[model samples]
Target: MPKITSLAEPTQLHERILVIDILRGFALLGILLVNFTGAEIARTGRLDDEVRRLLDFLISSKFYTTFSFLFGLGFALQLLRARQRESRIVPVYLRRMVALYLIGLFHAILIWNGDVLLYYAAMGFLLILFRSLPQKLLLAFVILSLAFEFWTSLPSSPSMKISGLLPSRYTPEMEQQKELDRTLDYEKSREAWQNHTLSTRSGTYVEAVKARFQVWITGRDFLWSYFWATAFAMFLLGLYAGKKGIFHDLVRRQRLLRWTMWTTLPFAFSLNLISAYGPYVLGRFYQQIPDWGFSLLYVLAGPLGSLFYVSALLLLFVKSERWMRRLSFLRWVGRMPLSIYLMQSIIGTMVYYGYGLGMYSRLSYLVGLLLTLAVFALQIPLSRWWLSRFQFGPFEWLWRSLTYGKPQPVLVRRVRPAEPT
Candidate 1:
């Protein structure tokens, strides 16, 4: 097994960490595809389709699941390092999670109300128990958590109508119309409508933060269930990969990558159609069996799809370093994921919040997607440039400083390695 090591070591990050940045940067960029859905809903009251849902369908196939799987991969890396040091993983891991949760809490308010970091942090650290488990057992745990998510509080049937724990009471036609009015503001509500896209991205930070807390505390039925479990699973899986030195040994990693590729590639290719039709069959025809089947398939498919996504990246990491250079911007965002993720929420909320520009319900899916891309495009390059000058991203520096309960060196090679902690 590859011996564990310190993620907090004050050494300058070398080439080994580059692939992670590349993958994370790519994942971060892709996650925006789905984030557009939430951004739009925050501004307007519709899912104005024709293009947005199509984009969502394209993204939902693998993006979020890839993010989740990578979470497991990272956790595994942390645990393995702690073990090698003969250190207790919980204290360090929990500290990291606490900081993440705090960031998440703040992000939910001043940005997008749908921030997942706090939930990921709160539930993220709990994967410690599964750390030492064999792959089969670790996978089983993942399966159970997803099953629970699938079967839990779902509307049960088309007649039952409710989808999740807090399904909307709106009618089908009304819902359809609401979606149409999203981008086509000049429609029926044109007279009463006001477009507020420009300033909302950062203007309503205070109120947005306040509203987020209320939503977290008050939404009893909507309390997050599987977020922690999923994140934990991903973390432990990462740990396993790290122990095997998956990142270091390209050949061995490539073999595993191949296995995932064969399995998930077929599914990924066909996933868009499956996801789109699965829901339509459920809602339009009460095809409960297929609906339930598809839901189950989604959770499993998510991981499988995520695996393929990783495999594709591995190919690029090994075979296409030149192409990778063009995306160096993504690596910056990946390096400072904690900061960028929260910033995304902040930006989204300001754009849509009632106190700001209030463009939440107005942005069409297509427009929302464009906005997500624009924000990420701006973020990726800036993040990379910032890290080139500093040891950590701004939020990362604060998190490390607070985590160690002392000021951490923010400049490269500035802090002397203190005698073995």
Candidate 2:
């Protein structure tokens, strides 16, 4: 029988990959930056076009893509460990996914509109379904998903034609009109929110729930399938990485890492630059043209950039003790990602929403950026402190208990009785 290492033991560093945790923590910084900016924009009105362009290029989808990749990698690693321990992994994993879905549902309905946990939970089930496939087959699915996204970006794609039944929501002409209506509605909602008169502020819990559903329903795009497809593609790549043990020994694999870094970095940067800027610099008429090129860059360059980053970090971890010491803080945050992620949403809403500080309309991008940094800084020390006393974060403990249909350990140590007093 294989020996089982307890994650509850903080000193057993060999059981966990510090680099992966560091990357996850780094991803959180980017995620919060984008999310905070989005919230600030909704609250205070839009940002300047130039600033918007910059954010689109730099901060838009990159971090979330990294996060999704890590999730897939983690899944593969978990399955491997289960096999090592001769355990039934599938049922346990599915239960965990379900628990995540429930948590996500509550977060979406009660806390935030931009919640991705539900989406992650949903996609995680698909990951399980595809986990046993051959590596080549997995790569093929990734390619197919990217192709689908590219095809959908074409203006002549049949999406609109299929949506003809829903004229008000689907038709391009109607969509344009709806955009205006949405802006006006949002302005009014913001005013209400600022005054603490929104359903979420002054009304009953049911009213707030209803409001949340309404927000989700209206915001869901027909292109949602494409989004999921893209996310699944990243998951597949992450699985491949885990299977190959790409992150196993960075120092020994310097040649491989260097090749990937040099090969991917240049194209990723150039492609993303073109994708972000081509619409404006080329012409306004170019904006009306097919965006397949942009989508292509996003699918191809985005992952390449993500991989390049991973390579860079692995190298740093292997070569620089000083950097490792500094980045070790991220390990704490990354270890309890779910707890930190949910905490961000709760704190963010309270800081910005009407029922709390009502500072949503007062935020600027600069202020939002500062706030993001501050929250992450707080979370680092907070996560370390919590882990010091507990076997897991509160939510993680609950999730594991539910997943295994039994109570899991929570506290790090047990009380000892005095003998022969």
Candidate 3:
């Protein structure tokens, strides 16, 4: 193996895919909508319920899966570049993950407990181990992982418990104790949520930080048991797509793209519909889906919906120049997603938290949705103007610099005429 000194450089503008950027920009919009209105807003009336239902069916879970897939695709691209340059990928990639993890820690601790970056950073290490796997094996792993996720999501499946891992000598007494412990855990979690809500809504910055930290700690079980697995599966899927060079020539792969888009749409729509309103709809027939069933549907819909979204966008880019131009505004936001994502959090906290506008738990779902759109609309032009003058977004520059152990050139230096010889 080569020395760690040989590392690949950052991707240049000419090498970027426009469709990927546009898709990322679109995902960011969905993420913003979900994040801003999520659990913070008050649900007061039918209007709020309807809006929440719509958002659940259309936006929730889909965008983050897309983002995770993109992260994997990006890793594949970096690996390819490293191989091309005959450079070692481990050193540079590890540094990148470390930097991302630190940033995520800052965001999660001081900013918001809902941060996903830390999870992504943790998964990045796992993804590195699979970088050298064959494409068939990679795809197989993704399918199996997703299948296992679905299996675990079924109501009939045995719920995971620490008692299950004990020796065969486990008796009825152990079962009773486990049940008692589960009840206690639930009550504790409920109390934690109350604290989180109160602090986030009206407490000082220090109080909010403590509350956020507590939330993060309590949420670890869900993060480890389900979220990370599905996210990693998406990462592998993206890596598979990248390794196959599918995005390199969308025109050549138009038929496949169309097939994927159309095939996934029915599943995405139907599953999401059931996940969102299965109780009401099925009750008419004197039947009802279990909570676990809804969870299963919601998890299954994420990747399917994300695939439909990406394929639809790629097809539009390939077939219609007009739509491409219309969506070109999103390109800027896509180009600097890190900055825009963090900015959304910062702005959202200020608008909702006690320290700023103090509107937490006050806005209705419709109002929150509208505010999300307005803020993202402003971000489009701001991102464009900022990127026009600089090589990268502020956070992106900082990330790159930290990864390389040196400051990267931020300004887009102009090429002046050659000096007279």
Per-model lDDT: 0.63, 0.74, 0.86
User: For model 1, what is the alpha-carbon lDDT of residue 22?
Assistant: 76
The better-scoring model by lDDT among 1 and 3 is 3
Evaluated at residue 207, the lDDT of candidate 3 is 94
Using TM-score as the measure, the top candidate is 3
lDDT of 3 by residue, 160-203 (tens): 55555456665799778877887776676667667877987889
The TM-score of candidate 3 is 0.91
Model 2 gets an lDDT of 0.74
Question: Clashes in model 2: which pairs?
Answer: none
Q: In order, what is each prediction's RMSD in angstroms?
A: 9.3, 6.3, 3.4
Output the TM-score of candidate 1. Answer: 0.76
Question: Which model, 2 or 3, shows the larger TM-score?
Answer: 3
Candidate 2 lDDT tens digits, 224-342: 54466677788988887787777776777888778878888888777667667776666675566546765677567667777778777777777898999888889898888889998
Model 1 gets an lDDT of 0.63
If both were scored by lDDT, which would come out higher, candidate 2 or candidate 3? 3
